[model samples]
Target: MFKRFQTKLLQKQVAGGYRLYTHPANASYVEKLVLSWDTRRLTQAALETLAIIAYKQPITKMSISSIRGVNSEGVVASLVLKRIVKEMGREKSPGSPILYGTSNLFLKKFGLKS
Candidate 1:
């Protein structure tokens, strides 16, 4: 059983419930491993953008870019594409810019309470 799970990531769907993804091979190790079933990998930019969104939710993309001191259009778009971040609504300020926030998937993935 260990040998089978050691070489590859594993995923299984729970009966009448959500899906489960695990990496048994990293059970005893210190670092967390990304399983194969994940829809998208979290890169450095993704992580930074996610942290900003998670902390300052309902924020505008302009704010995110300002905070990061770099253009985050691609990162934010990819996060939205991955269903991790979502457009909550539009800001009441100039241009009525779109507000971004962490989604339920982000909450579950990060083990955070909504």
Candidate 2:
């Protein structure tokens, strides 16, 4: 089961940072204590593309687009920028289509070892 208590505590901690309102004298202390927000957002399209890549790695962009029934070029670019995916080079075919695969970050995040 999920650890509800731990999740709640983390939420409280995140909220409490914003509630630290006091005299301007406490600015330094507040700034030091408040953690920098890490807004690591992944779009739904990118997530779907990632799932397809994870299970069917070394796949061409054309194949991915076919499976998703939509263009995944933008999503694939975002994944590459995030270091969650990498180009495994080109396919030995007519167009030499570029192949993509999950990177170490993807495996670490998904708890996959291979």
Candidate 3:
């Protein structure tokens, strides 16, 4: 099945020997998937984490927790899965924690220019 997809130009190889593809004639559907927020609701914790990441990005999880007064690892993971936030990179601190930031999709969903 995978070979058939490759032969039909439905998939292409990328770095690290991975395959990437998009559904043909589904740009609108893909856009909806990326931009639509009405289909799912975010928990309050997730929303708070997202707000912090958007304003204080590229911030570390520890910093976010410090501001929110709680650990936000799970909330951050949810935001990452929702494509609202992304892992920017690791910080230069003691543990080299991952930095988080809002994604381009987040900007699009919120109708922001930048």
* After superposition, candidate 1 runs with Cα above 4 Å error: 1-40
Q: Which residue pairs in model 1 clash with each other?
A: none
TM-score of model 1 relative to the true fold?
Answer: 0.64
Candidate No. with top TM-score: 1
Candidate number with the higher TM-score (2 or 3): 3
- Residue 46 of model 3, lDDT score: 81
What order do candidates take by TM-score, descending?
A: 1, 3, 2
Across 1-114, the per-residue lDDT of candidate 2 in tens digits comes to 357444333232354463323456556665555423221466788788998998899999999999999988988987886678999999999999999999998787668897
lDDT of 1 by residue, 1-114 (tens): 978764566556678676545565556452222222365468998999999998999999889999999999999998887788999999998799999999998888878798
How many Å off is the CA of 20 in candidate 2? 36
Query: For model 1, what is the error of residue 109's alpha carbon versus the real structure, in angstroms, after optimal superposition?
Result: 1.5
Looking at model 1, residue 94 earns an lDDT score of: 79
| lDDT (C-alpha, whole model) for all candidates | 0.82, 0.78, 0.81
Q: Flag regions of model 2 displaced more than 4 Å.
A: 1-40
